[model samples]
Target chain A: MTVEKISSLQNPRVKQLVKLRDRRPRDEAGVFLIEGFREIRRALEKRVPLRELYYAPEWFLGENEPALIAQAEAAGAQLFELTKSAFAKVAYRERPDGLLAVAPQWKRTLQDLDKIVAGSGGPGRPGSTTPATTSAVGAGAPDLQRAPFILVVEAIEKPGNLGTILRSADAAGCDAVIVCDPVTDIFNPNVVRASTGVLFSVPLVVAESAPVLAWLRAQGVRTIATTPAAEKLYTDADLRGPLAIVMGSEQYGLSEFWLKNCDLPVRIPMAGQADSLNVAMATIITLFEAVRQRAW
Target chain B: MTVEKISSLQNPRVKQLVKLRDRRPRDEAGVFLIEGFREIRRALEKRVPLRELYYAPEWFLGENEPALIAQAEAAGAQLFELTKSAFAKVAYRERPDGLLAVAPQWKRTLQDLDKIVAGSGGPGRPGSTTPATTSAVGAGAPDLQRAPFILVVEAIEKPGNLGTILRSADAAGCDAVIVCDPVTDIFNPNVVRASTGVLFSVPLVVAESAPVLAWLRAQGVRTIATTPAAEKLYTDADLRGPLAIVMGSEQYGLSEFWLKNCDLPVRIPMAGQADSLNVAMATIITLFEAVRQRAW
Candidate 1:
């Protein structure tokens, strides 16, 4: 198959890729970028539809780029080969692996979460209203046979922190991640890089704090909010059952709404001068605590 | 007292500050840069000697800058007030906070760790040979009557990860953090920022791997090396007693030397497609596991 070639940086597609780096363009176009071999590969594995792929062989660090490019093309993505300078113009990472893809933006509302809560564990399993044996399958499969384990964040500032949180949530086997009023959008290129492509594997949704809180309460999911002023230690809190760990922004912690609404408020003990851990670090610590409790 | 003012970016002092950003100039000058109000305040609190202070009022983010400048001056720091444009030239952060400092570099060998080991629990504590309650009544004093807790990192490439690790170590109340064959220098400006002033609070040392291992063995500290192939889960390991959690680099796991020399090998459970957690996240999880175990 002959691939289209674009050697000039002035190419409209290249210019569009650069513009997609910012949120307004990405949002208006209803698509975002997935860069590097690992990120593009993960998107393909998760069956995320790729619209187009741009490649530059001179920038590839390893032999696997050809195979990944082929796979992306086979997945019905248009292929474009660019000069190294052209690729560098659009590549977000310091070191580009010579592969980048454009994927359609996805959205999930609070209403979709009902399917997750009801799908986990077998049918008629205490609090779950939906039958697990129902024809629910694919990405949101109910294979774990346990109560729903969710992670929710409010107004995280850094794209790197948000992405790392997603990666950590996936590592802990979270059911879903619902970002509430994010300062940095999930589709930021840095977010994709920092997430290490876990963005594709994890079920993610973005919504307002009030609606997420209401949905969690309705689903019977116990909410645990992390804050520095909280009297209860995170370690002392009971983390089992249908749980959603609520984390706050880096500078200002969980808003008054979450602290008042969450079922329990907990603090990770701090012995040092710094008042709090990085949001991503705190999320991992809190989520793994739940993972530890659930292991029993 | 009136502070010396430098309005020109071409001034020798301003040029030196910019040069200090890179590793070679920093090493040659025997001083590293510490920027931002919180970081300088933390250094003052820790009694870290400040050789010089630079300030630009136009860039001050908060009202506390005047008080902090006064305090730095009181501590014998050479003060220089710079124009906004001059300060921007020397600033490392994208958003300059208008405060920066130059402090002389200090070094610590494995032998210094002996002081930490002996200083943690009181005199005659098990595994400690030196008398702790002697004239040791200063910063490394025996405040916590428990076994020595340390964190060791090998070839961590990112300044942000190293800084976050230090913060985590401080939060876990570790005795010290020893960087083994560091790929990124401990004094990198980003490390200072990412640590959020924990750098001053925590006892940190940069050394080679071989001697650090030998010293740990001599001090009777049990080392826990984190790797994906390890059979024992991190939580299952008894994190009590004198402990050192050894973390590897971002790209590669522990080097063969560490994997072979460390006392025990353990892994954090991973359910996601990503093979491992970010080094900083993994460090926090393992250290907090130790913290939780010791709490009990």
Candidate 2:
């Protein structure tokens, strides 16, 4: 596990770092980005396929730890020690913790998810341990294709917000995150960073609202629109069945078309002076309600 | 409304902008900072009190909307215009929106909340609305003071997350955000920015675990701790009662003290590979449940 140093930002290997910051390059390569020592460690620990590891020796104090260095070395990850200045040009964060890695997309299909659930012996997801659990794929779930305890985000403008929602989706164990009319790329560098790498952990499908909704309906998923104006409270609406919680941008909530088509309009209750929560915040509440109801 | 432009970062007025960004300065001066045209417009629309407004020509695009300029002038707001480059230095945002405003803090008290509910005749709080209603906040005839909802955020590190929680607190109409122990400053600049200025809107107070539990017990706020381990689903708990939902950081979850003190431990059921949601996202979910339980 020898340390190799790369000073030129234009080096073929260094160019990959620059490209990782750009969404198109990341997508074209079919690989996801992970940065920082902890993120790199998580990737290595997960046994997710590794592509390369870039480091700056002067800064990465963790390099002295043989075990940490050996783990990446064992995986055949390309290691590059960079000058701090050179690292800055390609690092995701201004203060890159001296380790960066790019890993092939963590691939899992709907069928693959089923196999994991069977293997887990509790449920297909974490935090879902109900003995009587409804199957997510082609089960009695409504809108099995269009919505099934899923989340549809329409026209979210901020990458941080979108990624934050993905983090929540991972926690709530929502089926998938459907980005409808995205204003920011789901694979944007910032989104991936903000998601704390949950982007890799979650199954994200991006599509236009029309097709997204159409697919959900085909799958027998009910479209539940969460809004400030609603006939049903979020908790009372039966979330135990096939469901997709639809939320909109912060300034303009679910579009009229989306709202009009909602099987149920649900809202989180509030008592303080707040008029509304941010869209990302709203998504967490609605998605978890689905989680709560199913677990109960 | 005259367009006054001053081009100098060293000017006394420019120094004031720096002070506004600092919480201590704002607190001593009894003010809060708001930047960007959209935020300024919202403040004016709310008829919120204003102290000052500053900007550069780049923000207005030379198309003068009298209303925007007049709102400040009518409010007797002192306006200053700087050279675009100087304005850029003075403004917090990279793409300077040009306009920045300083307004007195509107520290909402219990009495003022009563006035809002009475004037509008809206629901008092969660669990107070009609059973069939889905309006998140209006679900019930709100009970403002004894509003059972409470929030306990444990050891949150990011300023953005804290700010977002405050924003969620306002939207969820939470009683108060009880920071069990926070890792980041509640008043960090990033928190203020991310909250969309809700830092001034919500009742956020920090307290240790014992006092928090004591307050909950005194208020009869049923303490519900959210964790990955909880077998009973969040919805399974009687959410309608006086409730304090406790959620900790993603790393460790609610502290041992909270765990020992909580009346119930609940979880948002999940069906995904990722184990947890961001702290901010989880707070939104917990907050909405209180919203949902109280809605009816």
Candidate 3:
């Protein structure tokens, strides 16, 4: 394993890592930072390619730091020791966890998703094709052929909200999360943290609404758009079948395309003065309803 | 009719408003800042005790500024017209609506809550005790005697999460929200913004967990504690009647007092790698289940 000491804050690599903080630079470089031991471990478990791992021994909090570093090295990550100040400069969190990594950005298009679902002969797996049926199935597994549940988020602006939604989708046993026209980057460090690294565990794809709608239609998956204007209540909808729950930006409801083209549009009944819920909260309520119905 | 113009940022009242940004001064003064036209309007609608109203004519966006100013004056609020720089110094939001207010802090103890609930002969009305049976009954009213749903949040630290939960409780038509041992101030500006002024609409009380739980037990309200470790799924629990959903902080699960003393403990099913959901999202899922069951 190659190990190097990065002592200067002005190092070109450190400058590049700092630039990755913004969306444009991350996109341009096709890489993003993953901080914290748990997040990095999740990424490695999901086989996300790691270009480099930076750690500050003095600031490292976890007991298994050495083992985790060894594991990362085994997984082909070039390890580096960062000075305390240099580590602080690259870390996003207030209390540094003493570990950060630059991982190659991964993307799955609508077409690529088709291959996974069809090729796996079960629910699609985005990051890896191998069936992780043992660890993936928690209480009871969804009948992948008939009850594949998907979550579709559109134009979501907040990284934390998006990450929380991903976490919920994972908890509710969603087959995948389709992010369409997101205002926030999926690989944002905040997203990684807020998701508790569940982003790497869940199957995810990014595509425009038009193609995604068309793809779901082709696959015979019913799209349910959540909007306040819908007449029917969310609980009244049939979500036990192959389904996709589409949510819109917090500021605006679903776009014209989703409102017009989605198979069903339903609203979570709101009885108070506040017009709606936080988008992530709405997604959890909608997804868990499916979980309840499917279990029955 | 009494609107005095204040041109200096260093004015005593202006300085006081600026100091309200932090929790210490807000607590000491027993007052908090309310910004935005919608928030101020909601405060007025709820008859929240407004000590002062400040507005900048140049920055005011809404057409009803004059009418709102008049209404505040009629309601006994001291009105002030602030210079552009003076208003900018005190406003919390970017692109201020040219409206800000100093509202007296409101608190409700466990005993006060009993009076409101029992006095209304139903779910206690906060602002008006006459019981708004007409507008409060959204779709179908909960049989208040049998099915008054309350949300109990314990030791929640984030102002935004607490506020979002307030919004959800309102959306779910929860009778009242009891904040138990809160780490975040219920009247924090972020909470106010996140709730979108639902803070005014929802009847809320703040007290320690032990007393709150004791009060619930005495009132015959079934306290359902949400914990990841609970075996019973939240949906399966009987939530259609006199219910109080107890939630713990995001970092820690419920305190020993709640876990042992609450009537029942339930868990939201998790099928993915994430161990739990965001507290606000969890509250939405749990409360809406009661809403769904009660609808039947």
Candidate 4:
């Protein structure tokens, strides 16, 4: 098969790729654009279907672009070569790496996540809807058995903070990131960029907050919300066993719904006048505190 | 005193405020712009001299703007009222809160910090260069008296990350934040915005790495550097006593100079495909871990 070459800045394909930058077109078409060599490479590695791969050799930062292009082609992605100027016009990043791919958007529901979480434990319990017992693990729990460790964020408005939260969740080895009533599009190019391609590796679910809270109750996952008004400090809280760390939006702490429904509410001790940390930073601190506890 | 009113976007004062968005102009003029009601309020509370205050009544987000303007005026600021269009042209934030101020830049040296740190302890030893004992506090230290908990970052390129780090440092109640060879200007508007006004409260020092390291050594502060290659996990390290957490740039880990010079090199355990967390997130994780250990 011959690769299509487009040199004009006004090429129809370039216009479509540029249009993908906005949420309405991206959502309507049910697809999103992934830019940068690292992002495309991760997408291909995860076997995320690459509908089309666009390249401008002159814009590549390194020698690996050719191999990546070949791999994408072998994976059944249609190949296209754009002139340097054309690629520049379609790129979302300040410094485009000349590799951009259009991939179909995907979604996962709580039901889909239930299977994965249940399967990760010692014995296979695929499709089991049994609520996990609240006493599944005692304080100072043993680390022999794997438990569900999830992060739930509500109405996060900033794309950069959302992406960074995903990165932290990935680093802390979270089972999944559940975004409930998300204020920012998960597919926004900035989110992808800030996540550093971990968006593809991490299991992500987007759903409403009420159902997610209900689903967590059904899964027997203890929801722990971080708030300034909480009595117990995060470090003192028992974060072991099957758990979900719930975080709130940038402008507000956890919503009344999550705070009211969560099994435990904890606060990170703030020593300065700032009163609270950024949502992303707070998530990492809280997530790692749980990680530190579970390491036993 | 009658407050001056200007409606033209082309007014020389408005043009100068717009130019303050860039680093060179901000540094050359020895002043930087602070936008948003919260940031200006924090600046005023901290007694950061306000050279001028600019406001657009039509763009005010709340009824409290008039009180804030009066406070700034009483604090010796020259007030200017602008048309909404003029304020929009000069504002850095996407959603301006109808408040802006130009504050003169200030500097703090290691010598100055030495006085502050020495003063914060239970007893005053102002201007004394006597090195703190290496074993100021044993592992699992008590929280009776404060220790110098400083955050040192080298060559941070993004203004947003730099600002966020400052916010975290402030929340962690750090004694000071020493910036070494910073690539991003600390006064950049994005830094100010991302910091959410924590910039005014946090004691920030801009200096070179070698001297800061030397100052840390002279102060008997243990330097902790986080790297993926470290043999020790951050949680497992002894973080008590006077300490300085040194973070590297976003792209690169700590410089060889810092990595080789630091007392302890530890790593945050990463269990994901992504090798590391964002610098600001990592800094918070490590800082809070220290906060946890010291709380005991």
Q: Compared with the true structure, what per-residue lDDT tens digits does model 4 show for residues B220-280?
A: 8999999888999999999988899999999987999998999999998887754548788
Interface RMSD of each: 5.0, 3.4, 2.8, 4.2
Evaluated at residue B67, the lDDT of candidate 3 is 93
**Per-residue accuracy of model 2 over B1-296 as CA lDDT, tens digit each:** 57667787788878877877776787787776677765566556445566788777775644543467578879778777778877877788767767777776533223333333233444443333233221121223344544446677888887777877777877877755667666765655577577765554344556667876776675556888988788987766787766778888867777888888799998765544444466676677767776766766
Q: Write the per-residue lDDT of candidate 2 for residues A172-253, one digit (tens) a residue.
A: 7675667787788766767867777666545566667877766667666788898888867777788877777899887788
Model 1, B199-234: lDDT tens per residue?
765667789999899889988899999999899999
Q: What overall lDDT goes with each candidate model? A: 0.84, 0.66, 0.81, 0.83
Whose lDDT is greatest here? 1
- Give the RMSD in angstroms, all C-alphas superposed, for model 3: 4.8
User: What is the alpha-carbon lDDT for the whole of candidate 4?
Assistant: 0.83
Ranking by lDDT: 1, 4, 3, 2
Residue B167's C-alpha lDDT in candidate 4? 83
lDDT of 3 by residue, A97-203 (tens): 89999887776666645643443464443334454432332112233454568899999998988989989998887877899987889989999899988877776
**Fnat of all models, as shown:** 0.64, 0.80, 0.82, 0.77
Better of 1 and 3 by lDDT: 1
What are the per-model DockQ values?
Answer: 0.45, 0.46, 0.54, 0.45
